[model samples]
Target: MSPPSATLPAIAVAGLAKTYGDVQAVAGIDFTVSQGSVTALLGGNGAGKTTTIAMLLGLLKPSAGSITVLGTDMLHDRHAVLPRLNFSSPYVDLPHRLTVRQNLRVFAQLYDVPGPKQRIAQLAQKLDFTTLLDRPAGALSAGQKTRVALAKALINRPELLLLDEPTASLDPDTADWVRGLLEDYRAERGATILLASHNMAEVERLCDQVLMMKQGRIVDRGTPTELIERYGRDNLEEVFLDIARGRGKAAQPAQAETAA
Candidate 1:
């Protein structure tokens, strides 16, 4: 009845709050991420973006409210939901002593992935890591490490992918390649991605919608085009500046940026 109430979103956060003593890291934020789309979280320093993501991944307990991922309530059924999600961050590291292939093997086993060898081979080929597989992870270049980290994230074919600064420290060419790869992955699998990034251009290119945060609160949200239009700017960077400068209301759909 009633169309079966529709399926739950890939991710749902309601009245979510988190506080560290006197510092309220996140306050009453709510949003939903539909299945098979990319959602970008944008924020300046100390905006609670990291804290919010930590909670979504079940790495931290929320001070209040609720979170659900893929129809499982995070607070009540985290163990059931965690296996369906995976995270990748350029700032984090795999074991330095392990070869790239070994590192992936470890995670594949942890996720109880079937056909681990075939899965690793497929991902290595798809992600251009065939040669690096045998190389020690710490010995690889920064860009190479990023690729390996991504490979680890995809090893299990997770339903929900969480990325924080995924392309950080990568050269423009390499970053573009990685973006293309992610786009292909999304198109192929219809997976949901929640990305936290400072690269506005990349965000505009990859994200269908965005949540903008400031000082631990979600200050605004919309599609890239919607926010740009609302802020009277040609791009997201200017819109970000406007919000940071306390001029969020001045953003109008008609204002456009001058070419540099």
Candidate 2:
């Protein structure tokens, strides 16, 4: 794949907002993610990270703002661009009774991937799930399921990948392996990835930038190192702790930098 160029934004959001009858789930926010970048969306529960992702995927309508992916308006013309994007998370599941290969075949057909069997074979090998291909999906362990979900996500070779808690239930070693796979895929495809995760080390290791949210709004954004330095913390978890506890009063660190 060619190197990503910045002539056009891969993702752009302006005045993005979403509200429910009496509750605000995502307040108006704006940000941009460059092509071939891995950006992290982070926050404590109820922070609106998932809601924001849902909006981008056309799963939720924005009550107020606008979102554009690959120059296509997500709110109004997602169909034109949907095929270029894909998502994965442990919370999502395949058919319980289907064998892993069968589940993948169904999804491959959904995406209309050419050579479905070959594609599945490629993914199974790359993800190290070849041994589990004929096993019932429901019989797999949490870590195995995570790998299957990842293989499904990549079957389309998406230009834009969204991962929400991709490694939530994984052991540390398994999580690291998953992260490595993601990195390899991104490097090979020059894909744009947006990840919402609580794994501080993973984010610091893989993401080029991080956006921190709280109560439906983006409160801070920067490189992991930048946030750690600004918060005078040893690592992202400490910085996250400060923000979660309301100790980081200046959540918008774009205006100024303070020692950790």
Candidate 3:
């Protein structure tokens, strides 16, 4: 059966912009993620990917335009709905003195997650981190911490997950496991995921759709295959390179910025 028309997108943004004095960090860009879809946001170092995610999470107010999450205005109703979403990144760290279990418990409380202990136990087992649960977060290896961070992100059983280089710093084997775990979680829960990663292999392996951002705007978007074919490339990394280097016709001609 088709989804209900009134079923709100997991996320939606139109003409979103973020400015810091003279720096147009995120110029007007727009996109939507349907409920339960896994999408990748790809870009180079100075692309607007970080600013865009920050705006969507309500951490940074957009200078112009609007954002809707689960059908309501995020700018106005963020508190009412922010709990339904969560984010994970290797760059961020849990408190050094907190045990893995303690960290999970803290986030569970923040998210008002019911039966927090039981949820933590389940996540530890699922993520194969049961042995590390009682250890201080600072004691963990890079891969262990990555798994723990992912568990914390999942503690709320979020409807939407934002992952920023989730598998970063891990060895190839561990990264593969993390990717597989994410794939399973989304499959089992029908959750929406917004992934921001420079890992093209990971993107092609996990994302259903890809959006390429450059110089504060989205220049092109499509599935891995679509972009590969469009760019006449063998893989997503090649396509990403072509776009990042302005080598393809897909690059949109830069237009004058119009504040919303």
Candidate 4:
């Protein structure tokens, strides 16, 4: 089947490129994320996933090309468009000196969430953060911190959610819970998500489409099942390994192989 059209992507990128001094961080790449769908940007370190996201979020300028989020040009309408998006990354920490509740409150204020108290209460119940509210951010375990970060990301009721390893530090149960929560949020709000993750299983489970990057360029892309079938692999991990190890270019029939 053909990919979606280019009229108005929830997130649209074309000829996107970025360079720092002599190093080309992101070669010209193009992709479109449909509205209300989860799209995974998959790549290993230095694959330009972070650089691409930074440009989309208007945190970094692209050396070339254009990007539009929710039909608003990121470069020209950044001020008006920023409020419609929020980002969460496990590697990025919240304020260590503040308590969990304090951190949430600060962000809630920044987002101007109506009745911040009630919103906090609701998210606390949903995320099981009631007990950890008074604890300093630095004192929480990795999993706990991840939950708080996620809550902060959602406080804005953003149209576009950018998640970098949302489930990175959580145990299996908590991670599963977080995934379910994301599904529920998407269902209720029709939100679009751009996720970058190393967890291929999570990507397969959550993403409607996937963009695979290599050395700052998108070398391949498809749904998880499409990629798995195309690579003659049992799962996305194998596909990722093959690509990472320089075997991705080898021609193979698009058929599922027995699980290894």
- Candidate RMSDs in Å, in order, are 4.8, 2.8, 3.6, 5.0
What clash pairs does model 3 have?
none
Best by TM-score: 2
Backbone collision tally, model 1: 3
- Local distance difference test scores for all models: 0.86, 0.88, 0.86, 0.86
Please provide, for model 2 over 1-260, each residue's C-alpha lDDT reduced to its tens digit, 9 standing for 90 to 100: 22335676789999898889889988888889999999999999999999999889998889888899988889788998878889996656999899999999999999999999999999999889999999999999988998899999999999999999988889999899989999999999999999999999999999999998888888788999998887788999998888887776455555332321
Model 4 C-alpha lDDT per residue in residues 1-260, reported as the tens digit of each score? 12223355788899999999999999899888988899999989999888888899888999999998887789888887777789998557998999988999999998888999889888889999899999999999999999999999999888889998899989999999999999999899888999999989889999999888878988778889988987789999999888777676323423222210
Candidate 3, residue 195: lDDT: 88
Residues 1-260, model 3: lDDT tens digits: 12323377888899999889999988888889888889999999879887788888888899998998777688998887778889887657999899999999999999999999999999999999999999999999988988899998999988889888888888999899889999999999888999899999999999888988888988788888887887788999998888787776445454212211
- Arranged by TM-score with the best first, the candidates are 2, 3, 1, 4
Residue-level lDDT tens digits of model 1 in 227-247 = 898778889999888977777
Candidate 4: which pairs clash?
Answer: none
Clashing residue pairs, candidate 2? 231-260, 232-260
Backbone steric clashes in candidate 4, count: 0
How much is 235 displaced in model 3, in angstroms? 0.2
lDDT of candidate model 2 versus the reference? 0.88
Model 3 residue 2 CA deviation (Å) reads 19
